[model samples]
Target: MATEKLGIRVERNPPESRLSELGVRQWPKWGCEKSKFPWTYSAKETCYLLQGKVKVYPDGAGGGEEDFVEIAAGDLVVFPKGMSCTWDVAEVVDKHYKFE
Candidate 1:
């Protein structure tokens, strides 16, 4: 069966941590609890996860009907503008994010 995938782009554990430095320079760091949450992006966002792991699914997706993406420490993720998704945070997370 074919499955739909969220339009998030991820660079896993990027080399030299370039994403980390860019994120920190662009925005203030943010932290979140270990939990599941729903979110909609009003503006495009690019983020670097400093710590923790997460599984994110696009809206209205479940039961293995759609593909989800994982973002973890040292990962660089880009959430497109106007995208809506759910986040399953497996651990407390610290990230630096910037919106455009």
Candidate 2:
């Protein structure tokens, strides 16, 4: 069977130049979070992690197997609308996030 992937889309070490070129910083910034918690996205979101590490587990509410995605500083991540996930922040999590 073909496994289904949901929730996250990741781009490793996206070029800093690309970040500036796309004006990613123009979006509002979210401060570093020291605590881990579950988050549900009400809308599609794209973000750039400025620091820290995180592991996000899908709770299987999106019609696929439960799985996890690893995130870290310099990674660009996209979260689909209405996705349910638990975030296990392994370190201080800092990022800039914007909702669609």
User: What TM-score would each prediction reach against the true structure?
Assistant: 0.82, 0.82
Candidate 2: segments with Cα more than 4 A from true spot? 1-5, 61-66
lDDT of 1 by residue, 1-80 (tens): 11224678887767655754574556778889999988999999888888989999887555384568878897778898
> Per-residue alpha-carbon lDDT of model 2 for 1-100, expressed as tens digits?
1122454788878888978876789888886566678888999988888998988887774523446888889888888898888888888887888899
- Global Cα RMSD, each model: 4.4, 4.3
Q: What TM-score, to 2 decimals, does candidate 1 have?
A: 0.82
Evaluated against the true structure, the overall lDDT of model 1 is 0.79
lDDT of each: 0.79, 0.79
Model 2 RMSD in Å is 4.3
lDDT (0-100) at residue 43 of candidate 2?
96
